[model samples]
Target: MLKLLALCLLTSLMYVQIAEAGIRYYKWEVKYEYKSPDCYKKLAITINGRTPGPTILAQKGDTVIVEVKNSLMLENLAIHWHGIRQIGSPWGDGTEGVTQCPIFPGDSFKYEFKVDN
Candidate 1:
């Protein structure tokens, strides 16, 4: 709670350029399905009906808006940007219990963050 507050304060005091460059919107559906990447069929999480998911195209300083819908009947969903920094939007950081909470089943969460260095 304190960390969230401090992050919010720092972002507000600093220059926030989210959406200053441009805004890119994307809608993704999260669900579980049967997939085989190594010739073995197993249950796997797929985004938009794909195992690896779709590619997100963006440049530096651009704001990415992704609305993710969790279709899993008995699971929670949280998207963590592997190497991207969560700038100006820490609530959407997607670190589960750390930065944000999990999106419950049949629920949705909109992640809005800027692509920073």
Candidate 2:
């Protein structure tokens, strides 16, 4: 009986550890100072610094913090978390001229928002 009880306690602790795991790091790079062939005008742009960003395992009520580092020549960048509710989370939405301005080149910004039900 003692052994069974000990096993159950260990299992419970492991489950909790898995559930509270932090968010995975995702890296991205936005490029500027380039004109499109058709447009012939330099504008804002984005490219995955590391191809295929890692898939983050997130759950409801989990606080997500996406650390973005801009290394462009000219122009700032921000991430707009789509499909996620931003009722009180304007920073994470990453809406230029709305929620928050883009981060300048060589600058870093940490977007924090909680996923709630």
Candidate 3:
């Protein structure tokens, strides 16, 4: 029993240490712009003024910090991390009216979370 207990405690400490080891940060800006996706000019929601937004590249156990700014004149915005597991940071889920309020036009919000895959 004593040996098992010591092993369990050591395993838990190792897990915690590994989780806190590799963390990276990032920032992104969301903006509204006019673009021609199919040769037709139209207003589109974009990140950094580009359609389709920017792709985030991170390894497991990394941290990301995205600073989103709503530049639209009349629209509210929120961002969601589709496949990233936000384990302990539920408020950064970006589900407007659920996890957090919508970011109004001309306003900004910062999302900080660690990626756990």
Candidate 4:
């Protein structure tokens, strides 16, 4: 009986560990605006009106959800997740005119995918 109880406990611990595998979530809002990074003043497309867009930091096995908003007046926008191998999720690849359509001006799109290494 004692051996059976020990085995059950071990099984329960293993199940818990599997259930608690590293899983994370992130959200971002992307926009376009004009900005000048250097001394020269010029109009440049940016995220959230900033020169440099927000950086996303997540561990392996984490899931990210980014909501891109195209606030440009006369330009269509699309976000690309470069270097991210979106396994099992090809729709979130963000390839303009390829995986998805261009997000029209004043429109928004959500990108959901997992960061599996």
RMSD of each: 11.9, 5.2, 5.7, 3.3
Q: In model 2, which range of ten residues has the least summed lDDT?
A: 44-53
Give the alpha carbon lDDT tens digit for every residue of 13-34 in model 1.
Answer: 6655543568889999999999
Candidate 3 lDDT by residue in tens digits, 27-99: 6566667899999999887788778987777666677778787887888888888887678888888888998
Best candidate (score: lDDT): 1
lDDT of 3: 0.80
Quantify all predictions' global Cα lDDT against the true fold.
Answer: 0.89, 0.70, 0.80, 0.75
Q: Per-residue CA lDDT of candidate 2, range 33-96, in tens? A: 4446466654535455322344556777577777777878766777777778886777668888
Comparison by lDDT, 1 against 2, better one: 1
Q: Write the per-residue lDDT of candidate 4 for residues 1-117, one digit (tens) a residue.
A: 999999999999999766754545444445544556776777777776566787877756677777777777888777888888888778778888898788888888888778776
**TM-score per candidate, chains pooled:** 0.77, 0.59, 0.75, 0.73
lDDT of 2: 0.70
Model 3 spans > 4 angstroms off: 1-23
**1 or 4, greater by TM-score:** 1
* Clash totals in order: 0, 0, 0, 0
TM-score of 3: 0.75
- By how many angstroms RMSD does model 3 differ from the true structure? 5.7
Q: What ranking of all candidate models by lDDT puts the best one first?
A: 1, 3, 4, 2
Clash pairs detected, candidate 2: none
